[model samples]
Target: MRFMWLPIVESVRMYLQSLPEIAETYEVDLIGNLPKGGGSSIEIDWEAERGAAETVNTTGAVAVHLLIKHRTDDTDIWRAFREQYRIQNLILQEIRRLHDYILTNLKIAVKISATGVEPLGDMVRPYYGNELILVFEWKGAIRDGRYES
Candidate 1:
């Protein structure tokens, strides 16, 4: 609820604002643990198929349940981010900039892993709760940015 210095909070806010850039750089509609964002949005679903585990291609919505977080303790967050074309490229630039800042200045590394679930057979049926959890790891490095033991 308080701060010893202003730079601490300001630095935190800067890091928080970099979420959108990171997501777009990785070609994902949304990403990161956004501090206090996500206001309003919409979700778009399409049909597509073809993965390493599939024999015959299937057709279904190529989207997942857009994550919406509660703004406050009482109000529920109904935001569903729909993929947009025009802004993605611009966002990527910012992502890369943030990445550089993290790598060169912050001396930190980030990794993300994502998984998905599909129908056992090809039926093109609507499935429930098919998604994956992306884990992000930030390994802090030394001042020289070398691997820290």
Candidate 2:
């Protein structure tokens, strides 16, 4: 039994580097090794809405959440991560596009849940080896109160 999620571990450096504003906007703390969190026993620190330019928080704002989960084996984790890598790359390249689209197209509020959606996007973690990455995102922007329903 071999447990290795090096792909995701390796990609974190590049992924964080890719988004410089993330660090500047919100407080980010990297959690090494799995902790007593929810499922997967993995914990990562991320502050949503880092360096937001013009967050539209309104009364009628509707929040939407997006999610992507990868299921695979520990040794086969690379395959799942590859799929997410491309997706993240696309998102990175067209981040502005999504931002613009949300404003113009989606009338209601929008939020995305990248929880456990690591840049590596791998599943089938080894029960023994502590190798994991978690990605998270806020759904939408509303008033001072959080947006629900």
Best model per TM-score:
2
lDDT of 2 by residue, 1-149 (tens): 11112222233333443555433322222354323322222223333323234345332211212222323445775665664454445435634444444434333233332333323334335321222323323334443343433
lDDT string, candidate 1, 37-146, tens digits = 34322111222221223323211112222222211222222211122222322333344454455345444443423233222232111211122222223433243435
Error of 2 at 113 (Å): 12
lDDT of each: 0.29, 0.34
Those runs of model 2 whose alpha carbons end farther than 4 Å from true positions after fitting are 1-65, 71-75, 106-149
List the candidate 1 regions with Cα displacement exceeding 4 Å. Answer: 1-94, 112-134, 140-149
Q: Compute each candidate's TM-score over C-alphas.
A: 0.27, 0.28
What is residue 28's positional error in candidate 1, in angstroms? 17
lDDT of the structure predicted as candidate 1: 0.29
Tell me the alpha-carbon RMSD of every candidate: 15.9, 15.7
